[model samples]
Target: MKTETKIMASILIFIAILLAGAVFFLSGDQKTMSQGEGNQLTYKIDYSNGQKIGSDSAKIKLVEFSDFQCPACKGFEPFLKQALTDYKNDILFVYKHFPLPQHLNAKTAANMAEYAATEGKFWQMHDKLFETQEQWSALKDPTEFFIKLGKEIGLDETKSREAIEKSLYNNLISRHKDEGINLEVSATPTVFLNGVKLKLQKFSDLTQEIQKQL
Candidate 1:
């Protein structure tokens, strides 16, 4: 009977520790990152390279490290997009590249988006890529397909080919990927809000956090 009581007390203490951690999470710890569900980490944030939208002076910076060929990134795209639209006036939304090696076309996709950025069409190309990701994601080579996408979004096809062929934005994409690694991003669509990594499984998870900051 005494042994049972001690075990029960230990379990209660463990539960209390978990509750305290939840409270800390609610307190808005800004220096830590969660790599998916259970892994928590702390890493520095850098945005010297990315396509940006929204308020330049906003207190909240919502940053996404995404891979073009990543389906999980695609799945989360809508929620992230809605959050950006909803919080456009209240936060700075920046999209960075984190193309995985397995996704053959991912790096090319990033280059094409950056190519489009030069023509002031980054977001347009971005939408085009994700919208048609399934079509070109599996190709043995996707550069020509990317040029087709470029033309679809009003980018000059010949210039797009030149950009792809020359790999003009590869350096920029490389820098973005390196930055994501530095931030300890282990998966696609890793997002950080005001320096705190968010576990966003639904729209509410994001909006509620944004509201907390606002």
Candidate 2:
């Protein structure tokens, strides 16, 4: 009787130890998960000031920082457009200027887009700039091309030229670029979905991320 009682007591103690360890292990895992989530960087961006093309009450806000002269940005244009079209109701897409210093014409293009905005031709000029990026990228001066594009988009040639020459939207463009720099955007076409920077290899990957947010 005494031996049996001792044996039972030992068994109970071992079981208690095991239960305590299991609880600690589970709590540790939960702590680790919480820490990982907390470590994720969420940027605070002003989407209202940028060129927006979606519903204001969208659940998902996508902000794109791009350089007009960057080929990758041009390539991503179609995919971006498609995503906006497909998720128009759920997503608010904002285009922010981040013209790389290496690209002489990129800042000018961004300035032109902002100027076009004044005349209600921003989207048209934006598309035209990206569509014909290759044609004007290598020029010593792309002002002529921009003026021509302005004409095609029904912008006053003289006003467009003055905008470029006088840097009419310089402050706005500079602000956008500065904000991109502060956000650590090292490459063209850097994208953020709901303040979380995305590493997308393809357009489909972007769609997947958007769907996940939705």
For each of the candidates, give the backbone clash count: 0, 0
* C-alpha lDDT score of every prediction, in listed order: 0.82, 0.87
- Lowest-sum lDDT 10-residue window in model 1: 29-38
Instruction: Give the residue spans of candidate 1 off by over 4 A.
Output: 1-43
TM-score on alpha carbons, each prediction = 0.78, 0.81
C-alpha RMSD by candidate, in order:
8.0, 9.8
Best by TM-score: 2
Pairs of residues clashing in candidate 1: none
lDDT, candidate 1, residue 72?
Answer: 83
Pick by lDDT: which candidate is best?
2
User: Lowest lDDT 10-mer window, candidate 2?
Assistant: 29-38
